[model samples]
Target: MSEKRRNRRIKNRNINQSEKSTISKRSKIIWIGIIVISVLLFSSLLSLQFLEHFIIVD
Candidate 1:
């Protein structure tokens, strides 16, 4: 019975560790995606402003 309890505790600890790693990985992916999207949006806005200036000058 003590052996079984020990095994259970080890399994639970491993599971918790894996879960923490997965959560961190997921958050990292999400942050990367958000950064990419924001950069794209900023570039597009800059391009639009440049085009508008050109149109006004012409």
Candidate 2:
């Protein structure tokens, strides 16, 4: 094996690792955003129900 071939292989391996980590981080961020949105939506719904049950609107 030559030095150039060895270097190319190492470079390719590093790039693959970088791509995998980038994908993982992006997915984590997406999941966090979804969870936050869901919490906010549920809380708003609960508040609306509470108001309807306890108060009257004219």
Cα lDDT of model 2 by residue, 1-58, tens digit: 6999999999999999999999999999999999999999999999999899788752
lDDT of 1 by residue, 1-58 (tens): 9999999999999999999999999999999999999999999999999999999999
lDDT of 2 at 20: 100
Question: Lowest-lDDT window of 10 residues in candidate 2?
Answer: 49-58
List lDDT for all candidates, in order.
1.00, 0.96
Best by lDDT: 1
- TM-scores for the candidates: 0.88, 0.84
State in Å the error of residue 30, model 1: 0.7
* Native-to-model Cα distance after best TM-score fit, residue 51 in candidate 2, in Å: 0.8
After superposition on all CA atoms, how large is the RMSD of candidate 2? 2.2
